[model samples]
Structure formats: structure tokens, C-alpha cells
Target: MKVLALLLASLAAVSAQTEPWCRCAAFVTYEHSEIMVFEAPEVTIDSCTDDAKQCKNSCTKELNDFSNNGNLWLVQENGLTVGQNICTYMADHFFYFIHNHRVYGYFEVCGGAWEYTGVASQQLLCCNGGKHEHCISK
Candidate 1:
């Protein structure tokens, strides 16, 4: 019985360490010329907290550097007002390609190196003019 309990506890701990609850994706335009768009599932600002604000500030600085030519926007889906704000902050800090109904990649901000968790194939379509011809043939 004790052994079984220990195994169960270990399993639970492993499950908890798995990926996070949210999802995200990113995509760039042809030859990376245009700042197409990137999207993230409903992410709570609390999740980002320190990173969110720092990201937002960084975006603002980048935007200021580009000034007139800078083009970046943030959109939120099924998220709270704070989540929307976090997205905006990210857009301002990192030059991400974001759009409606499409996300290219997902990552956990708190995670180191902004490790990419998953990517959306559908969003990749935007990269090469809706032609998956150049995409890695699976």
C-alpha cells in the first residue's frame, strides 16, 4: 500500500510539472518583410506579471526606436482586460507577428529562453502566400 501511494504521488507531481494551461503561436510574412502577426491563447496578466511589464516596456522602447515605421499590434481572445494588456505589452516589446484567428507559435513567457512549446501549422500558411509548398514536407 505504501509503495502504491508513493507511485501515485510521483505521478501527480510529474503531471503538475507538465506544460502550462495556455497556448501560443507566431508567424512572419514573406521573407520576413512584413510584420504579419502572432497570437496567444487567453493568458492571464498574473501569469506574466514581472515579465509582462518588462516586455511591454521593452516593446515601447523598440517602438520608439522605429518611430514612424514601427508597426505592431496585440489582440486578445477569451481573456480578461489584464490579459489583453499583457498582449499589448508583448507586442510593444517584441516585434511579433499577430493576427485574428491565427497564431504561429506558443511559449511560456516565464519559461527560460521563451521556449517554444508548440506551433500552429495553419498559421504557417500565411508565411509563403498560403502555399505550403516550401514548408518541410512533414
Candidate 2:
């Protein structure tokens, strides 16, 4: 009976693929940039919090430095609202996302660096108990 149980448990564990991606800690969103007409300045700021202001600035700078022609943007112009909970994904030295905050919605980067918990875009994360001063470099 013990052998059977152990084998079953092991099999269950093996069933779920757990490689390349791990759970991510809570990260805060600062600015919401919606994708408007491409090739034109059509980005609308959906929202912005005072707490996450600096973090957003830092993240944007980091992203611009990380990408080409200031093209690698952290928040995809995909109607992402500010103060939402979003996870980061690393794909071959570059983390990618289509402004998606839902856990299951991340199909392309699912098996990448980080995986978020649960579902829903209504779920928002906070940094430093909402002060968000320490939201950078995470």
C-alpha cells in the first residue's frame, strides 16, 4: 500500500510540468499605457498612482535600455490599467508580455521566468504597503 501511494504521488507530481517558471512576488503597476494607432503617438494613460510613479519611471527607463530604439516597452500598449498586479517573464534574456496580467492568459511566456497566481485583472498588488517606494529592481 505504501509503495502504491508513493508511486501515485510521484506520478501526480510528474504530471504537472514545473520547469523554467516559478511563482513571482507581488509587483505593482504604475502607469497604464493603452495601445492606440501604431506608428503614431496614441498612447493614453489609463491610470497612474502617486505611490507607483517613481517605480513606473524607473521601469520604463529600464525597459527602454533593455530594448531597441526605445521599443522594448514594459507595459504593452494593450489597455493595461495602472495599479494592477502583473508578473514578469524572461524569454532568452528578454522578458515578454502583451500587457497581460492574468495568470492563464500568459500562454507564450507560461514556461518562462515567472508565473502569477490566480486569475482576474481586478487583482492589484501593492509595494511597501502602498507607499511603493521600494517597488523597483524586483
Candidate 3:
């Protein structure tokens, strides 16, 4: 019994360490008529932020007549696993506004949701989680 208990504890610790921080899904709506969805793997908040910025930039360039009022939904599955089973997590929805080919304004999924209006500029850099920040576009 002692050996079995030790093995179980070790497995638990390893599982906790290997687990991801969160999982998210993104959506884009064009002219309130077309909608596109993207599901991403489990990642950190900083990664998500970078992803959000990139998506907004790409969409603006791709769709010249894009509307500012669009929706983005993200689900935080804390201490959970994402695999073939996609029904285990609950998604928290957020809204975004695009103006002048830039991403501005967003809603956060925390403490009953909050809205913030701001402008963001993107710099192309190779960000490896604080390891390096080199220009990737130039």
C-alpha cells in the first residue's frame, strides 16, 4: 500500500505540471452577415493576447469593408484537458470593435464581464515567452 500511494502522488504532480493554462475559441463576424470560427489549443493569456492581435490585423486586411461590431468568444478551462471531447468546457463570450483597420475596444471574461475601449498597435517580433523579441517581419 505504501508503494501504491507514492506512485499515485507522483502521477498527480506530473499531471498538474503538464496541464495547460487555458483554452480559447475565436469568432469573426463581417457586416453582421457572415461568421467565422477558430478553435485553438490550450495556451497562456499572453499567447492569447498576441493571437487576438494578429487575428484582428489579418481580418482587417482581408476584409476591407469590415464592420467594427464583431464578437469573440473565449473559454477558460482551468485545470482541464482538451482532446477529442469538446463539450467539457464552458465558453465566455466577448465583443470587439474594429476601427480604421485597427483593433479597438474589448470585453473581458472576469468578474461578470467588463468593457474597455482602447487602441492597440502591433509590432512584428519573435516573442518566445520572454526569451527573445526580434523583428520577424523585417
What tens digits encode model 1's per-residue C-alpha lDDT throughout 21-46? 33233434344443324443434334
RMSD of every candidate to native, in Å, equals 14.6, 17.7, 18.1
Q: Candidate 1: lDDT over CA atoms?
A: 0.37
Model 3 lDDT-worst window of ten: 81-90
Off by over 4 Å in 1: 1-23, 29-36, 45-103, 123-138
lDDT (C-alpha) at residue 14 in model 1:
71
- Give the per-residue lDDT of model 3 (tens digit) for 1-138: 999999999998867653223333332224654222234333333333334443434334332222223211111244321110122211212222222222222223211222232322232212232222233433
- The candidate, 1 or 3, that scores higher on TM-score is 1
What lDDT does candidate 1 reach at residue 28?
A: 42
Candidate 3: clashing residue pairs, number: 0
Clashes of 2: 1
Per-model lDDT: 0.37, 0.29, 0.30
Write down the TM-score of every candidate: 0.24, 0.20, 0.21
Poorest stretch of ten by lDDT in candidate 1: 124-133
Question: CA lDDT of 6 in candidate 1?
Answer: 100
Q: What are the clash counts of all predictions, listed in order? A: 12, 1, 0
Writing each residue's lDDT as its tens digit, candidate 2 over 11-129 gives 99877744322111323232573211111111122222222333333334332332222222233445332321122222222333333221121111222332222222332232232
**Per-residue error at 99 for model 3, in Å?**
26
- Which sections of candidate 3 miss by over 4 Å? 2-16, 27-36, 40-42, 45-138
